[model samples]
Target: MSGKQDCKTRYPLLLAHGLGVTEHGGLYVPWGRVPDVLRAHGAEVCFGGQDAWGSIETGAAQLAEAVRKIRHLYGCERVNIIAHSKGGLEARHLISAMGYGKYVASLTMLSTPNRGSRVAELLLHARPGVAVWARGNDAWWRQGGDKHPDALRAGEQLTPAYLEIFNRTHPDACCVYYQSWGARLGKHNTDAAMRLTHGLFYPAHGDSDGLVTPQSARWGRYRGTLTGVSHQQLVDAQGVDSGGFDVRGFYVRLVQELVQMGF
Candidate 1:
């Protein structure tokens, strides 16, 4: 029941991670146990090894290579990509600008800020001192990612000013189908960290998944929001152990939709 073959898409699945996360180590997994769960459900899964905090162009290039590798290994023409957070931007970049559309069957984004989030815009303008934390985080972000410690710059890129330019330049691929999923913590605080982000993002952006509001996250075939699920709980496998939302089951349903779409 937990690991049923509910997501056997025609193409294999590629799981992409978000910002400030590196696809490494048991403890450092991006999609966490979702990979294992998908594999258990008879779907082949690969990880997109893009940098956590690199420029979109840079990260997408890395994703291009990862897609190539997946194609070679599976001996398949394309793979279905499920990306989270900034990885969704990288996925779009690959398909739209980097000549990767032909190698991607479908793109499913979870909690991606497609229209850009005001949270990132405000963070950069406020110029709060995240330097000390970023220094440590950048170490992992730079691992096979980008060179500079670019936390603040990454925030700038996630603003509408930048994404508007990005949408124009990297318009959707005619051959690829796009869809998205999003979530939100209950209005009442559940997780302290997510609560802080909810207060910050909701006022400016309306209901949000802690960091991204529904307005910014909506793209292509928008799936309805997952109530009571925070941005962190959206992807963190540890949440399953903590009696949180059924992360594994949620993905089972998401990927099953792709299977139904013939991807």
Candidate 2:
């Protein structure tokens, strides 16, 4: 119950990042200082280490491997996954379709598009050169150490139509605790980089965190929304903040709650 041991969960915490992101480069990869903060609070933290841009199936395979490594390294049976964006989908796949439910203690998703995103639908059909662009991105990421980056299929899988079938095929694992949190940008200018995405995604989906809408982010226990937080700020990316939200403190409390739940 002390501050030093506030986030000491029974199992190690695995932080999973979303599409077009990796936790292997720079000073701050995906979760920028989040893992450090968790560790400071007596929690063991690791990364999913999935491809920067890959299909959910491939990402889930990588996550399963990551889980295996983490379990062996820590000599623990299960891990508490805290995934963001597309990483949440991959975690779900790993838990259900991949039959790794017993290895996962809980899943807490941040801004995941569990019900699919309208932005993906628009990107898939709105532009004629979308496929071409995806192919280019795949090639680039492959050179960056991705063995099977499938940008086209990755984007396709995020569409509502595809996920409707995906949901049927991949139901939630009964053994794992699942919860999700949505983020809401107070305005388009909440994060300058998110302005364009906010402009495009807001028209049809209503309240959103620049990319995923609140409706699409709803899944599992639905842990409410983070007001004035952009998608980037959700992970403390680029050291940006919205409405003075304490990004690190938010995660500290999140992990503390998980510990309190005896995860």
RMSD of each: 2.9, 2.2
The numbered model that scores best in TM-score is 2
Could you give candidate 2's per-residue lDDT for residues 1-263 as a string of tens digits?
A: 23587888999999999988888752235788788778888999999988888899999999999999999999999999999999999999999998999999999999999889888888888456987898888888899888798988999888889888988999898889999999888853457767678787667767788888878889999999988888878888866555878998889989989998989
lDDT of 1 at 94: 91
Which clashing pairs does model 2 show?
none
Q: Candidate 1 local accuracy as lDDT?
A: 0.78
Which residue pairs clash in candidate 1? Answer: none
Q: What is the C-alpha RMSD, rounded to one decimal, of candidate 2?
A: 2.2
Candidate 1, residues 77-152, lDDT tens digits: the string is: 9999899888899899999888899888899888898889887887766565755556666776566555554666
Candidate 1 residues lying further than 4 Å off, grouped into runs, are 1-4, 25-29, 128-149, 241-244
TM-score versus the correct structure, for each prediction: 0.88, 0.95
